[model samples]
Target: MYCYFDGQFMPISEVSISPMDHGFLYGVGFFETFRTYEGYIIDKELHEERMNRALKDVRISLDYSFDEVERWCRRLNEEEGGRDGYFRWNVYAGEEGIGMAADRYDHPHHLLLRKPLQRTERGTSKRGFILEHRRNTPESSMRHKSFNFLNNVKARQEVTSLATEEGILLNADGFVTEGVTSNIFWVKDCVVYTPSRETGLLEGTLRHRLLQLARQHYEVEVGCYEPSDLLNADEVWVTNAVQELVPLHEIDHVSFLGKEGPVYSDLHEQYTEYVKERVSEQC
Candidate 1:
């Protein structure tokens, strides 16, 4: 695989970063992940918009233009000689600099890489999950896909290493937030329920579209949900741009009847159509 770093393209193995970089030292940076289909980026505008928003939040100066980033992505795609893959583009606090502090840094670096997209097994588990709250809060920087991921990483490790697929995160007040790396959604009486923006959920690219499309056929509620709400949910699912809509067979150990639920099927169908529309638009 090839990666673009600090204004140059290089093999992934050849790419390097300084230990002093804030992205590593202080976890100050922004990143976006998107997939390619038939050599075109999926939801390119949305990814860029989120990344730009991250930059805006931290008041970081971007030296490169949006067109430059797109150009680099296109070049890397061509060099990869493939039509479909995963792309993770990052802008990190650069090397040590004057007036450096943990609050912020200077001269952030840019890195973009392309890799093969791997799919997880779907339609396998018919059980739901049992979960323990991680006690995270929206004010704790949960929204940014920053280099700092210890919280989500640790929480995920607790679930994934046990052979379970995903876990739910909770806010400090015990309200359900999201999954390890994706947005959480559940179906109840033909309505879709997901964490609201106030819960500090990352406004995921697929998540936004999923909500929009779902509203066309069913009521989509973006609001706080507790474990009790999930317990009564007819069906539960999680979504990310990469994974799309995946049913949650179990939450912790409780089996959910999500496998054959009509609401899950509707959202899944809309999600598929959303992807198709975007890919078709690109073409």
Candidate 2:
């Protein structure tokens, strides 16, 4: 697929970054993965906020504006007949010598990647498992969707079924953190529960929106949680920008209502309408 790197658009195969880049040498980089509907990026402002927060936290600079970014994104979509696509924006500190610079990176490399969307039934359920690898603490004060993803990758390696299962990670304190690539939510006694940022999980864009929307119709709770608290729940679901929201039918032999859960059904419906409304406004 065609992608944008540096200042030019090229085939993804032709794009490359320097090995000496701090992002490679020191893991000084961040990214955002999202999807487009009708060629519109959903909740991009939220995504950008997350990106900007990471940039600020690590002293990485952005030389481009959102308008330019959106234009490039639209151009990439147009190249492929404008079908809905998965998009990833990668920003990294530019090449610096071997030693720790102890200086803010003024030049940053930016790359945009596009891939065809892989469709999954909206209400489909995925099994969940507790991973053996504990989630590492945030590199900075708070977690950003940064290139420091090896910890997540290592934990995901333990999943028995990648296609049908999601592996949840815990922190050193053994509190439920999140799924490999998604934020987790469970329902008990009509209340929705999810791990807070204090647990060191990258708060996904959709997860942020769900917290606000869920509050309008249901009592929502966010705090540190243990496996037993989640296991005792009646329903469970995971959220990410690409997948939106997915129900987990079982975790550790504990069965949930999955798509049939009343809370899941109502929230999914609400979330769907919310997307449609946002898409219409963009149109």
Candidate 3:
């Protein structure tokens, strides 16, 4: 595999960073992950927009433009023979001597990495378990894809089964916030519902798209919801950039009626068509 470091493309094995870098020492960095289809990034603009907001929030100076980033992605994809894959763009404090102060870093370094994505079987449903750990609210409010991911890592470790797709994380208030890596949504009585951003969940790009798409055909509600709400839901779904949309068949002891419920099926079909259209536009 190859990755873009600084301003050059090199083998991932040869890439190295200073051990004293602020990103490594203090976890001061921001990143965005999205999928590419046939060399084109899905929702490139949306990702860029979110990245800009996150960088500003963390007081990281923006030195690169979205167009330049896109060009590099296209170049790397071509170099890799144009395979569909997942990509991560990371911007971190470049200062070698970091002492928990951002003022020391004059400029940040950006790295782009890609890895081939294995396609999953069609109609596959994800099984999740409500984790014992609750999301720490105040810090989670940032909602940026920062380098501090130990919380998510620990939550993911609780998923003992390989078949479990994700671990559902609740907020301190005992409200379902989101999955360890994706946003959570459920349907009850033909209404689609998901946790609001106030619940300390990241506003995922796919989650926003799905909400917009579903709103056209169903009443989409965003608010704090408890575990019982999900357990009694007629259908449950999780959304992220890579997995896209995954219907939930079971959560812990509560098993849903069907593998893919009617609401999920319709929205998934529409989402697929939407993706095709976007990819074609890039072509």
After TM-score superposition, what is the CA distance of residue 62 in candidate 2 from its true location, in Å?
Answer: 1.1
Identify the superior model by TM-score, candidate 1 or candidate 3: 3
The order of the candidates by TM-score, greatest first, is: 2, 3, 1
The candidate that wins on lDDT is: 2
What is the C-alpha local distance difference test score of each model? Answer: 0.73, 0.90, 0.83
lDDT of 1: 0.73
Sequence-dependent TM-score of model 3: 0.94
lDDT of each residue in 128-189, candidate 1, tens digit only: 34446463554345367777677777776667442347777787777888777778888888
Error of 3 at 201 (Å): 0.7
* Residue runs of model 1 more than 4 Å from their true location after superposition: 65-71, 97-106, 120-130, 133-135, 139-142, 161-164
TM-score result, candidate 1: 0.87
Q: Lowest-scoring 10 consecutive residues by lDDT in candidate 3?
A: 98-107
lDDT preference between candidates 2 and 3, better one? 2
What is the model-wide C-alpha lDDT for candidate 3? 0.83
Q: How far off is residue 150 in model 3, in Å?
A: 1.1
lDDT of 2 by residue, 1-283 (tens): 8999998999989988899999999888989998887877778889888899889887887867665677788889899997778989999899887976686899899999999989988888999988899999988888888888999889878987656899999999999999998999999999999999999999899998999889998999999999999999999999999998899999999999999999989988998999899989877
* TM-score against truth, every candidate: 0.87, 0.97, 0.94
Candidate 1's error at 14, in angstroms? 2.1
Residue-level error in angstroms, candidate 2, position 26: 1.2
